[model samples]
Target chain A: MKNQLTVILAILLFFGTAGFSFAVKPGEQLSDPKLEQRARTISKGLRCVVCQNQSIDDSDAELAGDMRKLVRERILAGDSDQQVKDFMVERYGNFVLMKPPLAVNTLGLWLSPVLFILIGVGLFWHVSRRKPQTKKPIDTDETEHRLEEVLNKMKKN
Target chain B: MKIQPIKFLPVIILLGIGIAFAFGLRNDPSKLASTMINKPWPDFTLERVIADQPAFSREDLHGKISLVNVFGSWCAACVQEHPMLMRLANREGVIIYGIDWRDTAEAGSAWLEKYGNPYRKVGLDANSRLAIDLGVTGAPETFLVDKNAQIRFKVVGPIDEKIWTEQLKPMIQLLQNET
Candidate 1:
């Protein structure tokens, strides 16, 4: 009886924690079909707030879903693409977009590759200006002495 | 051989700039865009549909914490995400708005009846002018605005349960505390 009670209690505890941990919060359903389709397309461009490098469309994050629904609502309400981006940028900044805007805030993002090319060119200049050849002077006296020492060592061996 | 410091000036400067720029591009924990703690929402005027009329201007959304959704009836993914929206409507303190992008009123309304009417107010983007302004290159984007009428969070795509648990909840938490 004691063992059976313990097993039942353990099972109950496991299920209790499991139920609490993954409780489902039923989200608002989107009724407008047009708005829903619009949600998919916009999500493709927007970055996932949770996952790095993942678009909201591709992400499985909970926020991504809300965002999709929110986008659909905005579209239904008649916000344009730029307006939506501006809205998000105003809140989250340009990092939310996979493609950052070409503005003062993101100037370096668009120019760094060119900057790297310029650095490469400058490095090339430094490398190419080097002398083709430099002569090494011979130490004849040391050579002669070493040769004598080697011969003597060889003879001894 | 000794290296001349003057000759290395350009190289040093380039290295410094490259390093500085690279570091700047990095994703800083404290500066994540979506995690922006407190900021004013972006200003926008959306075309709305209320009481069987043409698009009405969404000027009244300024002072409320509201959601702006961009969607179209013809989109397939929108259908997939509909149930989730229905669920979100039941959550606390979320004011949902809708934008019907280029769809007929009959189908839009019918779609709502089928999934569930989650939005408090609805709009119609028959001409897509609002979409252009919002930088909506495609369908289905969402924004969360604060009580002071600033957009605080954005999500793009059809929603699912996982996304709600991970990304949406945190943003909701932030928005909830901001009030």
Candidate 2:
């Protein structure tokens, strides 16, 4: 009973921390129109570093919220779109961007589909070319005759 | 041909490694990777705070190697990171600018007072518009802007002594050399 309770408590704690970790409530004040526009532009392409399949603008994760706020501040302070992207990249790497730029580190990510197609083709070729082992069609009479001949030949030899 | 146990061992090991790698990649919820550094800085103007006056604007950022910190009074991490910010502000050629994102003017001022006022300029992004422009999701993020107004480095989380000694300082040095 004690062990069961402990397990339940541990699970509760894990979920509680997870929920607390990332939850972006709407800001008390509406965001500035001009700055908001600029922030969105940068965020649309930035992946949520903390959440699966979410851009910073769409994510509620703490890190995503932080990234969004940072983008706004920089825009108001006077940063350009490229500059904002550059900033995110420096800290989080190219993976933070939804559209990762062409670079050596991301070659594997970019070429996966093409590589997978080639592998599929190679497997198909190997399967198709395999040697077929055909079974000989034998009648009962033929089998008996062959057996008699084999026995006579063995005796003669 | 007979199958060797040793050959199967190699295959099994390779399969295990492949499965482990795929699982590891999928398990990480955060896909953090550095994207763009060595890019131009975004441009904007903000109101700066001072003892007895109206707030200032982007003109103040001219001709300096500056660090732009997007933080807010409401952010817990901002409070946590204030001291490290103070240390960085004290360094030469390192101007710290604060963007009080999504906070009221009164609250923003109170936050600065409670913590140290290390920012050379404090811009009020009362409306979340400014943060949106910078692609900010939330607060306590930092960007390193060069003398030419290009962004050199960015630190997503709080800046600490370890980050300073290893990542930030080295980046600053690289920028220093480039210019």
Q: List where candidate 2 sits over 4 angstroms from the true fold.
A: A1-52, A55-107, A132-157, B2-36, B47-56, B90-94, B132-138, B170-179
lDDT of 2 by residue, A1-157 (tens): 9999999999999988864442334571127776666677677788885564878777766556766777766687788888888877765566677997878977877897897688668767866887898987878898999999999999999
DockQ of model 1, rounded to 2 decimals: 0.09
Listed per model, the TM-scores of chain A against the true chain A are 0.55, 0.54
lDDT of 2 by residue, B1-179 (tens): 88755446447757977997988778534323333356565556555444454553556556667788989888999889998898788764467888887677778888888887888778887655555445454567787877777667777768888988898877777777765
Best by lDDT: 2
Model 1, A139: alpha-carbon shift in Å?
4.2
What TM value does model 1 have? 0.49
Minimal lDDT window, size 10, model 2 chain A: A21-30
What TM-score would you give candidate 2 relative to the actual structure? 0.56
- Give iRMSD, candidate 1: 9.6
lDDT of 1 by residue, A2-61 (tens): 999999999999988853341112353346656555655666778765564777666655
